[model samples]
Target: MPMLYLNTRHTLPMIGLRVQHNTVDTPITQPRYEQETQQARAGRGFTQPKITIDSYPSRHSYGYTNNTDFARENLERGMSEVQKGTSKHTQMAWALAEDGPKAGRQVGIEFAKRDMEQRVTRQRTLVAAAIPDPVIQVDPGQTHGAPIPAKTTPIWHTEGKAQITYHRGSFETYLQQKGDIHSWTSEGKYDIYA
Candidate 1:
């Protein structure tokens, strides 16, 4: 014979189960909740979220410096002013009054010449900074082989079917050995298996 258990508190006996009821509701108390809510509704207690963004050049990006561009623009602008006889140097030279027109033209031309020289120097400096000289290594005691002449034919023209097949095989082998293929399924789940 097996024993039976019953919960007699309910009208129907509940076997292998217990029932609990929470009739009283507890109120949550937050500090200044009503005051803050009222102030928010009145547009008095809220501030817009602050967002900041920063930008920087990528490590692999290749470009000239801002100073180079500025130098070029400044040179052009100064030359234009000189041509228009509106440059400060030209005006100052004309103020001397002894040979106003000739003095002004001479000063303006000198200023334009100096600006061109500075612009060229800046461009050269930038080029130097961007490209470095290659380093060569030599073994003095080792016997050297005959120099190989550079090939004139393009690599694609020289490559045969066997070479292309070999390259494909090598690439496939590399992918099988080291590649991790990830994909997304139609069910919106990520799959790691290829």
Candidate 2:
């Protein structure tokens, strides 16, 4: 079971926008024995008859036979532009962390005393666990992408360990499977990636 093959070689030339392709292997279509519709299974299927191929791939090579709006303005002059996101230094780091209004009210009262010491250590470990029944019944259209119904809700959690999140549509499906939206790229993944 020795399988460690990498060979990861991608050193240049991928100049895309190809617009022309080919791959065919067609040759097959024959069943005109007088358009035989089972004449008693072609007279009891004679044993000297077997010709089957029926493979097709000839789409007369794609479309566009000149309805040229200057060939779509030369395919939009090598079409590309579609990148976004620009929070201007994340709104100047939250306006320089709220431009010191009394040191942002002492860092919001030390984050409300560390969120009241994590809600008094989660109400003292839920005082021996047995209060969860609050969901009496919430059929918001058969409950799906939930969490919004709330009279008062801060049930902030995470003693850690609980994953499966991946945001931003799994980062644009991993940047459309390893990005290259027809080239012209720039990264510095926002907030200047720490």
Candidate 3:
């Protein structure tokens, strides 16, 4: 099971400038670990194994900004304020769509509604399916960076069909493989905000 811990903070001026915090613990039926076991058994495991990579690229063009000079100035200033780092937008979009196709469609619709160019072009984010058996070995000592089994040619197979159903305030993801089910609750402020 996957454990989620959340803490909410609010100011309490009535009690001599004190702070109040509420903690919520929600246990979730963990995502399947079949991939982890397969990677280990296949000897493709590494000190750091990247199981999933989710990304959301916001391709919306900001609406008109007064005039060209004003836009140019803002662009320069914005570029200066930006720093090189892993962005949270990617994970956020994935989280919104991870619930399933209905939720995923909502994500694209929301993004499309925001961009004025929706008629000409639509900006959307997609969540990638679980990776196949191709695992990367990061240990320098392991096989000198060559993929295990040495593929002669590329082979492809479906990752299986996935469907999510919502009941009450919880959702269950059903996989085609042996009808495996993963459940999650839609509780807490994070759920509301998302």
* Per-residue accuracy of model 2 over 50-84 as CA lDDT, tens digit each: 44432221221232234554468557654532211
Q: Which prediction has more favorable lDDT, 1 or 3?
A: 3
Name the regions of candidate 1 deviating beyond 4 angstroms. Answer: 1-60, 63-105, 126-194
Ranking by lDDT: 3, 1, 2
* Better candidate by TM-score, 1 or 3: 1
lDDT (C-alpha) at residue 14 in model 2: 42
- Model 3 misplaced regions, further than 4 Å: 1-88, 95-97, 117-194
lDDT of 2: 0.38
TM-score of 2: 0.13
Error at 131, model 1, angstroms = 16
lDDT of 1 at 96: 42
- Per residue, candidate 3 scores C-alpha lDDT tens digits across 1-194 of 45453534333333122233444444454454322122222444444433442221111123333466578888887776563212435544674767436632666556556545655676577765543443334433323243445234334444354444443443334432342333334433333332
